[model samples]
Target chain A: MGLTRTSLTAEIGRGANYTDKHDCVVALAGNPNVGKSTVFNALTGMHQHTGNWSGKTVGTAFGRYTYDERTYSVVDLPGTYSLLTHSKEEDAAKDFLVNETPHLTVVVSDAACLERNLNLVLQILEVTPKVLLCVNLIDEAKKRHIKIDIGKLKKHLGIPVIAITARSKKDIERLKEEITRATDNPSESAYTVQYDDEIEKAITTLREGGVGTRFEALRLLDGTPEAGGDSVPSGAADAVAALQIARTAAELSDEIAKALVKTAEFIAKEVVFVEKATDMRREKIDRVLTGRIFAYPVMLLLLLLIFWITIVGANYPSSFLSNLFSSFEMPICRFLQRLGVPQFFTEMLVFGMYRVLYWVVSVMLPPMAIFFPLFTLLEDVGYLPRIAYNLDRCFHKCSTCGKQALTMCMGFGCNAAGVVGCRIIDSPRERLIAILTNNFVPCNGRFPLLIAMTSMFFISADTAASSFWGAAFLAAIIIFSVMITLFVSSLLSKTLLRGVPSSFTLELPPYRRPQILSVLVRSLLDRTIFVLGRAVAVAAPAGIVIWLLANINVGDASLFAHLTDLLNPLGKIMGMDGVILLAFILGFPANETVIPIMMMGYMAEGTIKGYESLSALKTLLEANGWTWVTALTVVLFSLMHWPCSTTLWTIKKESGSLKWTAVAFLLPTVIGAITCILVNFVFGFTL
Target chain B: MISLSYTPMCALSPGECGTVSDITLGGAMRRRLQDIGLIPGTSVRCVGVSPLGDPRAYEIRGAVIALRNDDAEAVHITR
Candidate 1:
């Protein structure tokens, strides 16, 4: 395996094209985990971080590159297996290709694994012919001792083929030149798959019945109405009714699908010859990791380890950041005072608003920063698909596609991303189920709350020996929460969201090493900031209101204490104080602010309750009339509680129904309350 | 008695047949139905229904495709 010839970019000096209002549009299509992003960055001279995994490009990412004075807008379509839209990314790519109408579509194939990638290539060719075959990752392909006949592949594809290691820009210029040339002379040829006799017969029938176009003919054969499921015109429905009179529609759809798959398989066998099957080392390990017997326990243990690591890693940084940010308050207060702002306004803006903002950033950022990169590492290593595969059984039992596990995995980072990720689950019933249950997997905002409670209430000073132990404890709590979520979802499926699960074929993407630094930076900025920003935006105002309540005296005590007293009995029954309940209510907008508001409530209204040790924290709570039962209740309630407002808004948007959103909120709250009551009853602790 | 060459899939008048000619799928509607193996060339039959009659279930690909009557109207086929 030899490295390809390297070429240097001799910048052709020319004035930038100012008159061209619309730049040349190029679409970047590829298999997941190939270095398409690296190529995008290299070509564009932009530093959009790259990760070693699929699914990161949840939405089509667009960037610009200037070549020979002309700027080309490159859209990075999500990596897909086939253009069949088995998942959301595939659907997005197919739709973008058909509807967006980009000037040039660059389909990036992994040189090492061209056969699997070619499945998509052939499908895309059927849709449009203005395509460029970018044989990317030539370096990886070379290491495998495989050589591709570039000219042959190009001839086979009937399109321009460029061999590239996208990380290096050696042949990028040539590739760009080819793209420019291809755009100038757009190809109009389309590929067709040879169908089985039955499919040919059905296609002929459908076509003669009036489905004239190839793509339309194929879809009609598959049974998807040309319009979406929700918008079937009356005339079309009438036609389908008439068609059904001759042959069973469902059987015809299945036959066409089988034909398409058989055709693809035939093409694969003809074009690809495996030199030697994939190194059996990974396969042997996958046997255990994704095995029949050990898979479930292994998945549980692995998930537990992830949770444990996240919690332990997050604690020190959370506290350190909290203390450091809190220390800045005095200086900020003095500076604001020096500016001669009114006293109350100064307090509101600085201690109230600024303090909450600081709390949100300091507390939330560190955990997400640590958690996302580690998760990204697992993703890059290609464990997410296995997780999905293993969990598919559970999804199937619930009458949903197994791919919903991917969305559930995304939920751990942020529910908004998870909601967006739901586009991957092809079945509407399953997708909606995934969407509604997404909040059950706590997002970055809620992680701190869970971690803080676990650290404060569960861990004793003697137990707080190492980060590993803390992480283990956190993992246990998370595992418990997930189990509860799964239980609730199961119940929902059986009762409210009941139906037989739809069938779907899920493709397991290969493992790759996640690009560490890029994942960290992007997730921290994109996920952490987005969540924290929402939290801070809500926290600032909520903080002022809390501050005012603490300061403003009511009949006997401060307004804060008065309200807490009024709600204390019910809170006590739930094993929480009025202050804690208030914190949860206030934190509904964003969980990042809960700790800060709780601290502020404690600080201004009562004694200095912050502790340097876990035991000391426990002692403080115990002194405040808490018990082991109380601690347990708080953790359980937090696990099953309402999602943050952003998640709720996403639910409303995705479901397009206020009724479902309300159900999403109330269902969780009800579960939380019931669990708390049941725990209290079992423990025999009366508030 | 045999009647017309085609009948609408959405017509509450059941026990009809049609050949699917074309399909239109995009937006939320596409997302909702694509997961159920609703590709073209599948044989379909109108099955029995619930009381409300909004979602008319059609058996396709050895499974059920439950779509609202309005959605069923989009399929243009011929007997």
Candidate 2:
């Protein structure tokens, strides 16, 4: 079946566009890690951060640039080695070429390894003649002592070839000029792959009969029936079916692929040269990083280092933001009161809505701001794929794609983004499995809760030891979440989405010196601000709801307490109280609001409350009869519970099925409930 | 020299190198293998194995790629 309209619209909606208007559409295609996005950003002046891993650009990103007083809208297609594969990225790049039929398709190639990259350029050349080969990363190639004869390459391919160092904005103006020329006057190159006799005959017949272009027919014969949509008359269908059956029987795809590879090799040899090849630094690094004995320890140390940095670095900014926002609460409240608003209205608006929003910002922003950049730095340094490589076997044991590890890493920033990142997994079933299990990883929003509870219960003393222990405990909880994620993924694949784990080319790209400024800007704007905006959007409505629930009473107790009473028994069985359960239910909008809601519930006040420190929060919890069991249970429950509403909405949009959305919701909630009950049972008996 | 015997890629020890002989798989897996420049006649070198000893990294066409033993087994190579 074709992609549903909803998903297509959602995918398009995620891309950057310029006011729904443009003079021309130019498509950017490239192999992963080839600086396609860098070129796009430089050309469009957009800040789409270049991720240094395969399939990181999992969706189309559009940007607009003005050339010769004409606005050219550039579509950055997902990086793919070849459009022949059935992966979502390949399909996205291929389908846009076929369906959207853009004015020009610019194929970006890495100058460091133009031979391997030429394979994709040849494939794109087959589909569309309106093509320009952009050999990017010339500086990197020069550093590696490789050279490309660009003039000879352009002559050999009979197409415009522009050499550029995307990082330095070198030759970008020439690129813009070339784009203007190529789009205005499309030219066909002499590049063509000569398949074996049988495939060639079949392609010729199909092309002559108007079934499709030779490239389209070859794609169909290469077992992509989805590519035959444009030529689907009854006669053409019969001819296509006969051709497919014959081709399958003959096993001609391999032969055709061999021919394409030969052509690419030939062209590469003609156009590219390597001089004084030095020892690859990446190999030496990989020997240590992915070595059998040191890999796990190194991975663990890195994880701890990131968390340690986040935990320590975030405190000052978090406290500063908290003090800053809290200081405004009184002034804002007084201002509202002075405006002749009633006390209750003022309290609801200021203390309830405003307080929760500020608290969420203060708590969630610092960690996310610190964590996402660190994560992106790792990604930019090409370390994330190694993490995926390290975890591939574990995920394979769970009968899911190893790419899920990368999505889980993204989930650490925001589960919604993780849910979207599931698109990187080509298989629908595995993508669903990734989406359903993503929330098992604690996001930045949940980090505050995990860190706070760990500090309050286990690391009671306000010492350096306490902070270290707190970070370690937080790390332990994260590891536990990962374990639960694997367990649930295994169970789901076996039961619901049954399949063996599929293999993908997990390209361990060469490590580059990360651009720190770009990493900071990208992590802050693309990740931190985006997620914080979402939290704030959901937190405001939740604030008013929490206020109403605490303020409105049935008889003697408020509705909040009544709901707490309803869930109190279940909460007790889970080693948590009713107010905590009520808080979780109300905190559905955003996880950062959960603790604030609980604090408000305990105070029995009509408004949310903020504490200056974890110790003060712990003191407040102690007043409400919290113990070690309660703290442990809350941490465990927070680790396992239903994903926040943002994640759920993302799930619904990604899965495009409420049934799966319901499954995604209930899967974690059920697991969380059961885990809490079991933890509480054992702790109750032991303590 | 064309070696008649083909060994699965998983048989290669870490740091061992081999040329791809044939891919005994079909559909997306086969296409993906080829897309990453792992076609027949291309040389692949086992660079390292993960701590778990299942998924191993191989250097192919100047790029390091990780493949599980299961997928590696489908790749017939000749040393």
Per-prediction TM-score to the true structure, in the order listed: 0.76, 0.93
**DockQ of predictions, in order shown:** 0.03, 0.68
Q: Model 2: residues >4 Å from true position, as ranges?
A: A1-22, A227-250, A276-279, A460-465, B1-4
TM-score of 2: 0.93
All-Cα superposition RMSD per candidate: 11.0, 3.5
Highest lDDT: which candidate?
A: 2
lDDT of each model, Cα atoms only?
Answer: 0.63, 0.81
Best by TM-score: 2
Cα lDDT, model 1, residue A74: 82
